[model samples]
Target: MSALDAATAFAEGLFEELRVNTTDAPGITRAAYGAGEEFAHARVRAAGRELDLDEATDAAGNLYLTLAGTTPQLPGWILGSHMDSVPHGGNYDGAAGVLAGLAVVHALRQEGRRPERNLTVMVIRAEESTWFPVSYLGSRAAFGGLPREALEARRADSGLTLREHMERLGLDPEAVARGKAFLDPARIHGFIEVHIEQGPVLERAGVPLGLVTGIAGSFRYRHGRCLGAYGHSGAVPRAYRQDAVLGFAHLVAALETSWDGLEREGLGATITFGEVATDPVQHAFSKVPGEVGFCLDVRSESEGVLERLHAELMAHADGIAQRRGVRFEFGARTGSTPAILDPALRGELAQAAGRAGLRAIEMPSGAGHDTATFAAQGVPASLIFVRNQHGSHNPLEAMRMEDFAAAVRLLLAFLAGRPA
Candidate 1:
């Protein structure tokens, strides 16, 4: 069988094996630092063992399956992605890239083909920030970029700290707290991630794959709250009432208006108040709400645009608070700066894709990935996107096997042609 065929079969098999971890729906629930994630990692480890690749886990639980080259001392290449998924997310989101890496090496091994430089297939941990509210934990830790405070942050459900989770997994939390770099920056030639494009651009453009131009960065307020005086809903006059809900409503509207204007003016940006609600204990049908809690996420490919958006958001909040006589309390905000893909690697990928007779679209990624973390650490990084449908982060994500095969072919070509 061709390498593309083998990789496709390998990915399908792995997907079926891991799909049983779902709960509440037909999607995966392999949350980061959870049992499901552990199971998936075990499967990857087993696969690496079958290929006779040397395997190890880093201080933060990132798994590396290595195939040494003739000159192992030189900086090597890494092909990898995360293994964790969001709650009720699809099977292919993160797993596809990981399996693609393994399949490439497996195909090479079977064919007695060896690369000139060492190649490491990485299965990173906790790339999905849904559970911990911190993005790319595994990759960041590998690059010594994870903040110390993130180590002690508690998980939303299990209430266990990230450090606790690491200890349970037999990884040294102390090393992570010390901000250890498991993979030396100087010893890494490049990082490449194959991922499903979570947007409709590729599918709409009628292409099987795409080359990522850049990854958008984001600022998030995970636990923001607005406060105002509580008063009787019926008795309080609209002019006199300090309605917190109204204040929050106005804030959302203002931010959205600005977002709309910015987009119309050709600046690409997005804002979402993904979570918002009034306090159940303090809220009543007969009473005006005194508090509003929400989560805010703002993303952009341009740092300048993001800075302006942040300023406008704060200004709108201030105006809403003043006009409504409400107070705003924003929780700890975290963000990563925008990252541009390496142009040279991108050119290589495009050439490889062309040689393999696959048409590819070029676009920017709205969602963040582990590739961004590697780029932030000064590594030349690239991301290849396989066209997918139904918008990602849910069970309905539909990626065709044909597209998967096309991506595998491109990946194999790229790996085979890399400079020694």
Candidate 2:
């Protein structure tokens, strides 16, 4: 078998293993700094050892496996992505990127070929903000960019502070809080990530891969609430009752107008209320809902669009409060800035794809990725999206092994005979 074949098989086996071990019924769960994530890190680390790669880790538990270059002085490549997944999310979301990196390195080693510069496969931690409300938790921590207050952020399921979680895993949260950096942007040649497309664009385009141009930024309210006074559903008159659900519904409807306005202007933005519900303990079917809990996520590649949407949101909320006799409490805002990818590197990858007779499109990412973290740090970076089925972040998310093989081939072609 060829080197690529062996690596592909390795990835296939690992994927199944991950799915089996991390099974959470409907899908899989790899909570940030949690048990499933721990197992994944350990498994990948074992693979790194088998490959004889140089191993290292940071205060934030980001793992680095390096295939050392012949020339120690040249700037090297860092290929990485996070390992954690959203609750009941599919197996491929973040894991594909890491496995692609490994496949590239494993293929090179199989042929006993050494690159001009070092090649590192990084296993980033906690990129899924679904577990802890902070975005890019592990990547930002690698650059000492994580805010101190983020350490206090509680995990959504476990209700433990990030500090406590880190401590349980025998990792150093103090150094993380102190802003200790493990990666130097200047010394890196470039960063690249291979991930499954979270949307249907590539599958619809009849293509196997896409080279991302930019990644969207987001403003998220994870613990938003609508508060009102409870009343008897049958007895309370419509004029006097304060319905929290109606207030929440009005806000949802009002945001569509802003989205439509942006669409009319040829601007792109998305407004989502991912979670919405009234308190289970304090509510009944016959009672008027006194309160509603929700989480709002607004994203766009343009900062201007984000601001405009935010402004419109506040205005709508104000009007809704007065008319519905309810108040909105949007707890602690967390977000990330949009990233413009390195086009020069993208052009080079495009050239490689062209050379290999593979069809790859250039597109903008609506979803966020750890690659954005690298781009924000002034590192030259690119994101490659492999075609996927049924979208992402859910149980039915799917990617073809053949399509994955195409991505690994693209990376192999790009890395082959490249300059230092």
Candidate 3:
């Protein structure tokens, strides 16, 4: 069979396995480092064995499957994407990349085609931060981006320290901290990732594939403890009473106004107040100390712009807090990741897309991914995005099967070293 034919068959089989492994009644709930994730790792290892690759697991639970080349001593090409999904997420977001990588490896092996350097397919453990306090745990460890204090950080829901959680999952946190069982920086020649667009860009443009330009860096702010005294709603004077809800609304409005100006500059900046909390009890006679907290997710394609916006937003928060007479504490829940993509690899992806009879456009990814962390570590990395159904990170999230197959074909062509 031709390499493309083999790739198609491999992708179909992998997709079937993914569906069986991930699907639940409400939708796919394979949250990062969850039970479903462990199942995925098992399946991925099996697939690697099928392709006659050597599979190894890192201390962070990231899986690496290597296909030796003619000159194993030289730096090799790497392909990576996370296997963990968001809560109730669609199947394609991360799974597609993994299956695509498997397909590429299978096709290359069938053709007896090997590059001058080795090829490594990496399946990172955690990409979604919804359950885990820290995101990109797997990729960060691989890239040596994890700080020493991270070992002590506790998971929000589980209240277990990262070290304890690693132990529970059969991984050694100390080895991970020491950067053991990770790819050597000098051994990775370049990296590529195939992922769903997670937005409507490609589908709206009627394109089949995207040659990713860069991934957007995020500046996340946790605005917690907006305090206000509660009194009888009917008896308290509106002018004198401090309303935490009103204070939060004011802050949200101010953030929107500021973001509108950024939007005008074509910076693709966004601000989302995704959470809010108030006192649970409702009492007319008792004085309630209302506390409100919300998240500010600011993203930009430019690192410099992201930093400037972060500073500006913090200043705005302080001004709003003082004006509203609310005690405000601003904490950075996550730091910004600068936009990065491998220019040479991106060009190669575009050429591959063209050769595969696929339409390709360069676009920026607004969401966070393991690829961003890898890029930060000086790895030449790029991403390929298939079309998504509406937005992602929801139960109803989906992507076209044909689009996925087309992306796989393009990726196979790229791996086969086909010229434009």
Candidate 4:
């Protein structure tokens, strides 16, 4: 069989095997540091052993499957992606990249070709950031980017600390906190990640793949609350009332209007109020709501745009609070910085796509990925996005097998060629 055919078959087979780890319902729930995630890791490990590749894990629980090279002294190439998924997520969110890397190794082995430098397939853990508030847990810990406070963070579901969860997974949290690393940056030439685009950009453009220019930074208000007096709905007049719900409602509308204005003025940015809640015990149809809470998330490719958007939100919020006679309590804002992909690596990928007779467009990722963490560490990193029809992080994510084959073809070509 040809390389493409073999890779396609491998991907199908792997997907079938991975299906056992999913829910009996419509989608998968392979959460990080959980049984489903462990099952996925076991599959990767078993497959690597079948291919006669060496396997290892870092202190941070990142799995590495290596194809040895001809030159041991020189830095090698790293191809990687995460293996965990969001709750009831689709089949190919993170699994597609790792499976693609495995297919590449399998084909190279069949062809009896050894790379000039070592090629490692890295399977990182907890890239979804859905279980814990911390993002890129495995990748950040591996590269010494995780902060000390993160170790104490609790998972949203089980409420277990990160350290406790690591211990449950048979990993040493102390070793990770000590900044242990299995992959050295000096010994690594570059990192390349293949992912299904979580948005409809490539599909809209009628392209098979995209060469990512950068990953957008995100800022969030996860615990914002509003306080006002509780009064009888019939007795309280609008002029004398301190309605927290009213203040929150107006704030939402004002912020969205400002966001649209910024977008119209060419300051590309996105704002979302993902959650809003009134005090459960105190809320009733006959009483004015005294307290309200919400979550606000803002994202942009440019930091300047984020700053401006944040300022606008605060200004609008202040005015709304004063007018409604309510107090605003916005919790601490948290976010990750934007990281631009390596230009030289991008050029190489574009050249490789051209040689393979494929058209790949340049785009920015609104969602975060493991590549951003690598790029932040000053490692040469690039991202290849396979065209996806539906959006990701849910069961409806759709990508054609032919498009995945296109991504694998480009990956093999880029990895096989000499470094630029």
Which candidate number has the best TM-score?
2
Clash pairs for candidate 1: none
lDDT of each: 0.88, 0.93, 0.76, 0.87
What would the TM-score be for candidate 4 when compared with the true structure? 0.96
Candidate 4 backbone clash number: 0
TM-score: the better of candidates 2 and 3: 2
The alpha-carbon lDDT assigned to residue 28 of candidate 1 equals: 73
lDDT of 2 by residue, 82-139 (tens): 8899889999998999999888888998999888889999999999988888889999
C-alpha positional error of residue 137 in candidate 1 after TM-score superposition, expressed in Å: 0.9
Model 4 C-alpha lDDT per residue in residues 15-41, reported as the tens digit of each score: 778876666357887788887788889
Lowest lDDT sum, 10 consecutive residues, model 1, at 19-28
CA lDDT, candidate 1, residue 184: 83
Name model 4 segments beyond 4 Å from true: none
Ranking by TM-score: 2, 1, 4, 3
Candidate 3 structure, TM-score to reference: 0.93
Error of 1 at 110 (Å): 2.7
Off by over 4 Å in 3: 282-289, 418-420
Considering every candidate listed, which one attains the maximal lDDT?
Answer: 2
